[model samples]
Target: MFDTEREIIESKIRLCLDCGKCTVVCPVAQHDPEFNPRLIAQRRLSQNSHSPQDETIWQCISCYMCVERCNYYVKFPEFIHGLRAEALAEGAQLQCTHGGALQALQHMMAREDLLQDRLSWLPQDIELSEQSDTIFFVGCAPYFDIVFSDLEVNTLKGVEGALRLLNRAQIPFNILANERCCGRDLLLQGDREGFLALAKANMQEFARYGVKKIITNCPECHYTLKVDYPNVLGDTGIQVMHLTEVIAPLVQSGELSLGELEKRATYHDPCTLGRCSRIFDEPRQILRAVTGLDVVEMEQSREKALCCGASPWVYCGAVNRQIQDQRLTQATATGADILVTTCPKCQIHLRCAQKSRDGKIPQVEIQDLAFLAARSLDIGGESVG
Candidate 1:
């Protein structure tokens, strides 16, 4: 398997025409000139040996910007994942942010029999069934709230927004009694076995509930369940849809009524939702449907949008801050009152960047798309609690 994987990665890298397009768009290379994708490809091609301890491999944020920019369609983010897997197999230590506490939490959740109170954040007004054919996969929002409390971000609000929308639309969905992390963090950290463990546990729970469809507010959860889970666990014959995809149609068809927002906002396309999953229009369409919400286009909107500068909860530093600051600058340049993003991770990272600045508060307020939708529906306030 390892040999086949290496060969596949090499085949992709072989298509590189020594063009510097990948480096030009790389977030890390923009700040840290030493970490260049073109050079990494050249070095990997020239050397017959594979080193799991390559520091440069972990520097990639897996934003897929290089893949988007590559004329030859080389999958640079996938290539980095392959390299990271080899490194992990060689007993290499990954540079995890937050002292690896979040990664540790994921590993701790792998136990199949562990019981969790994951639904503590479910609002009192939201109604869910004991069991249903459809399940709401609330991925790690509670954990994120606990871990990132210092950032003063209501990560769980995204979950609330999702539940509120479902309730208003009268869509019956069941919440998982024992949902674990989606294992995206582990997969991105190069822990394939750990990811598989979490995947198996989650799948077993899904099977126990006889779930046929899943709705998720988190893009990482949606991507992992819809795309990554099938790769390892075979097709579970389950359909997964992000909250934006589900809500877009409601707003578009007049099934769900949204009141006026009366604010100018710019949408930041989360890398997972836009570049990875190809969901570019639904969120914008939802925003456009609002009565008074003025949707402004950032210079880098849609597929060309920049990443939030952190991935897998690891390797965040000066370079990451620079990237986040630059993206926030671009958002502010639009003169929009708010910067709206569909992913919780994007909201947290951008909010953190906003707070870290020494001067006056950031001109633009960072918000999750779901929260805005909930506000328009008058189902819930902006706060989590």
Candidate 2:
């Protein structure tokens, strides 16, 4: 166990220039006056004392906004990640959203004897190539469908859409027969051991199937596979790609032509794909390719895109709802017929805000980019929708 506290203090927190910019732009600090990134930094560096158990450590939604605005490139979200790990190391219990069910599921997936019934939801029409080295990393869509059933969130729509598009284009790809969660939430919630176990299991599966490349629609899974794995485990010699990266180029090259969709839509940039990975254009490119679909931009988009209120599935409540409502309001402001995003979690959280009985939040139609695209795809020279 590395000294997360000491490392964060020395490498990131201590580099703070006492600038209050992080707090000013932080969504949490903006709402809760008690939370300040600058103050947190000061406390960590205080000669008197330091405590990772501070509530502020878990309040961060891990939006990467601080990293976006920091002049010195201080990774505040990452600092909190380290602090959360430190807190857990000291036996501090963290409240995982969804009653810690999702976290527990990830832990269970790490077990060697676990058998994953991951393919029951897969439709028969989308054929898989057993010989293909490229695999569609489904992430936790199957489990999410069960967990968020109350919200009626169909995360598998995106996965099915991805498969449909790939099949339409005659792209050979396979799905993991026994896939596991990417452990992004676990890692972000400071469960390093859990994350490593999942990572190890995933890596073993990848090697077993000779998976040289991964294509996933879920932004969190894409980010975890593409960036987080390499960062924590060194080079695993794999190419990780978001579904947008695959679809956009095919559309642009005229290999895949999308049918007309007479609807106005606004795109939500998933933090993982846009801000973190700098993948701003690929989704937009595919969206723009569809005929009759009027694309509108939200006021805060691209680098300044608002997060969908929660991440890593922990401690989500008022602040998360506020952020989600704010984002939904922005999407509504564009007069879009639908709010399209690449992240399934974004689809859920944004829609969850609209479900509130208070009716204060706007009830905008939310669709995953892949699902929307699949509905508009021209397969067999006929429009699917």
Candidate 3:
């Protein structure tokens, strides 16, 4: 922890007494010993380790399990994120493949051609509430990129479904067409300046748009806006909500029926939403409301759920693949056909991992909750027509 950058972040590391509890509860360590949160915790505790070059740092899936499980209340994820940020700042490069992903994020954020085109996924018939109180701040992810190709068109079905639910219930909301990346990836990757710039830009946009409250479909975006934004924006008087929480009430009120899914399903808790923000029940409740579906629980569910392996501001492909495989293996063991997740990042990355694997491992379906809700739109369907 005596590293120049480590000491700078030491205030946050005030009292991590080498308790291996972080290790015990960490899925990265459980799935692969190469990743030991306790060891990282210990290194963070050590005062002499200069220029540590551990590949395991790149292996962290950015899952907040260690932080949540830490009895000492160490913000382990923050520590890890800080460590990664230091590495990037020092020009300490990981494999180029993962680095390239960061480059792609930079390119995406800097280019409106990529950003605006993705928004086309929304059904033209779907109404855009430009003057509403809430804005669903969809993050940049491969899932939404595919769906919203015309502005996330392929994926607008989910957003449209939620909007329909809101509209049917008369909830006022709108969207920011000029919204940029939430800077989560950059922030996690140790690009402090980059992150700050993106955050400031977004904060300005939110203020300009009169975005009193924000709802996000991506846990990473949700965590960035809800948890990190305030520290930088100085109390912008905005609220950040996960889509599940926003729509869970609708399902509970019988306003959004999930329709009948005569199949077994399991839910994957994204680290950003579940551990980062303590959001576990909302998504589960949304799933439970669906008719004819058996919601099975994997050995690791809720706070203990394994990470989908592509977050925390960096993308180490090999390690992430390992984590994703372990998660998929565990998910497959539950005998569930559909593995539902709320975060677009988790859904897209897991889908990429699922496609990378060979056949016969339960054709696990990965979908966002909004897709199911849209399918249950008893009233919105006629309106879309």
Candidate 4:
């Protein structure tokens, strides 16, 4: 299976034209000149050996920038994942930033008998149905808070924000008590077997609940379930949507009322949500509906937006920090008091950068779009922004 996957990925790699557009748009290549997508393709094509210890292979960040920028339609990120899978199969150790604790947690979730208190973060006031066709798939928020608690980022707030919006819209949704990680990190980290196991287990759980539609606040989860799951498990007979996709229409139709927020804010497009899924307008639409709130554009807006640096919770270093700092600088340049993004990981990564700054760069408030939208509804006590 691994050999067949590698062959398929290499077939895509063979289409690289060496135009250097991918390298120009890559956030990692911008900071580390040594990291070049064109060169990586060339080297892979020239070499017949698969070296799992190749450090450069793991630095791609899986941002999909190369694939987006490729004129020949070469899927570079998929190629990198294939290479990483080969490496992992060769017993090559990965340098996971969280000391592999998060990976271990994901592996633990694959157990069929494992019981998780995943809904502990759900507010008591939030309305949920015992048997609903729609499930609000809260992806890995419980684990993210524990993993990134040191950064003081309340990852669970994104979940709360999502729930608040659902409640305000009066949308009947169900929460899965045995919800598992969407296996996005595992898939990106080249743990194909692990990712498939989690996907299969989660699908079984979803089947048991008779889920027809899934609404997720996490872009990674949205992408994995909407795109990856179908590829791996065939037709899932389920519809997947990002929270913005669901809420934007409600805001526009006057089904949801948003209070005026007197602040200027810029939106950061998560790669999965924007470039991969082409969900560029829903977020902006929702933001514009908030009266008195000004939406500013960063130089790199929409498809051209830069990554938040960290991905798959691994290979974070000086290069990733530089990318984050550059993105924050751009956000500050917009003169927006707040920077809002649709992905929880984007909020966490940007907030981590904001916290570590040495008081030199102007600090912009980092917020999740769902959180800000929830605040605008005035359903919660304090403004998340």
| lDDT measured at residue 305 in model 2 versus the true structure, 0 to 100 | 91
Across residues 32-76, which tens digit of lDDT does each residue of candidate 2 receive?
888898888788668754543587788898888888899988988
**RMSD to true structure for each model, in Å:** 2.1, 2.2, 4.1, 1.8
lDDT of 4 by residue, 1-385 (tens): 2454654565487777778999998899988988988887777667665543567888998878777778777888888888778788888788888798888999999998988977766778899988789999988878878888987777677788888888888899999999899999998888989998899899999999999999999998999999889977889999999999998998889887787888999999999998889899999999999989999999998988888888787788889888899999999999999899978888788878877886665588888888887777676546444
Rank all candidate structures by their TM-score, best first, as comma-separated numbers.
Answer: 4, 2, 1, 3
- Candidate 3 per-residue lDDT, tens place, 301-373, comes to 8878888877654545666777778888888899987787777667666766766675543447776676665
* Candidate 2 minimal-lDDT segment of 10 residues: 376-385
lDDT by residue for model 1 (1-385), tens: 1343763465387799989999998988999988999887777667655643558888899999998999998988777777778778878888788899988899889997799877766777788876579999988878888888887788777688888888888899999879899999888777888988999999999989999999998999999999889977788899999998998998889998877788989999999999999999999988898788899999898989999998788778889989898898888889998898878898888878877885444548887888887877676555322
Q: Rank by lDDT, highest first.
A: 4, 2, 1, 3
Better of 1 and 3 by lDDT: 1
Model 3 residue 27 lDDT score: 63
Error of 4 at 170 (Å): 1.7
Between prediction 1 and prediction 4, the one with superior lDDT is 4
Among all windows of 10 consecutive residues in model 4, the one with the lowest summed lDDT is 1-10
**Candidate 3 ranges beyond 4 A from true positions:** 1-12, 94-102, 107-118, 141-157, 255-258, 312-318, 378-385
Cα shift from native, residue 332, model 4 (Å): 0.5
Query: How many residue pairs clash per model?
Result: 1, 0, 18, 0
